[model samples]
Target: MMEDFSGLALPPLFGGHILETELDAAGVELTAGTTEILESGGTPQDIQKDTRELDKRKYQALSKRVKELEQVNERMLARLHRVQRLTRRLKKERRFLMKTLDTYGDDYRNAEITIPLEDEGGANLDGIPGGDDGGSSPSTTNQPACGPKKKRHRVPKEKERDAQ
Candidate 1:
């Protein structure tokens, strides 16, 4: 019976010739020294209470990590949604522009960036400005304005409104 340890699948019931239930501590996370256990009276309940406390601490740390990852995931999802919306809008705009170019390709290719020179006396095609009311800025002498011909007001996006 003493030489039959291979059948039990352990490296023999090793002990100091007195204790046979002692296990090797190869895979143990912590090994409380013999004197340390004796100082705590070696009570099983105390050992169990310590193990529970350790597990609770590990659980709390893992829970906090999971919450942080969840917040990051939410931010990533919102950014992804915003990117998808912008991509869709860009694709639609590109397709519309391509269609418009196909219809008026030659016109765009040949057209120069020149605003119809305001009437010499500042009288527009509408026959409306004789002199004082209709005035073109000296800064806008020749080159076309970068923006719209009229003072167009734009409705701001929600984010831009908040920023403002």
Candidate 2:
């Protein structure tokens, strides 16, 4: 792994690179994590023979750590986006529920369809099925719309048993 002392183009390990921070010990805050190809001509094997094993282990550990951090950060970013969307959905649902309560008052009971055609207060909070323009008051209505009872079709016992 060597040529006769011709410098800058040959090294113990061909195409050797050193971490930038290792090259410049001072003012390395800006150049950390960058690599610089070796240019020094001395036999790097002879100069730093003893530390190669240690450096190899450190490189493997650092590479694994970088991959691990990248995966965890990616998952966290995905979860953050999901949480943001959920927060927006919840806010919109809350606005809808609040508007429903304000327009109709606390008139609902166990999901009943008995919407009041008139209330004592002036606000016409009738949730009229098709005629609701969302701007009508109680005085605008000529007749009260009584919610019709839901018609239930009873399936025959023989059909129910067959479905089961």
Candidate 1, superposed: residue stretches over 4 Å from native: 1-41, 107-164
Worst 10 residues of 1 by lDDT: 18-27
> How far out, in Å, is residue 136 in model 1?
34
Query: How much is 119 displaced in model 1, in angstroms?
Result: 45
Residue 42 in model 1: lDDT: 55
Output the number of the TM-score-best candidate: 1
Q: Write candidate 2's Cα lDDT for 31-136 as tens digits.
A: 2322221334446674364345445655665475457657867888998999999999999998898789879876544565756653344443555455445554
RMSD of each: 24.8, 22.4
lDDT of 2 at 126: 50
Clashing residue pairs in candidate 1 are none
Q: Estimate each model's TM-score.
A: 0.43, 0.36
Clashing pairs in 2: none
Superposed Cα deviation of residue 5, candidate 1 (Å): 49
Q: Residue 59 of candidate 2: its Cα lDDT?
A: 67
Which number leads on lDDT? Answer: 1
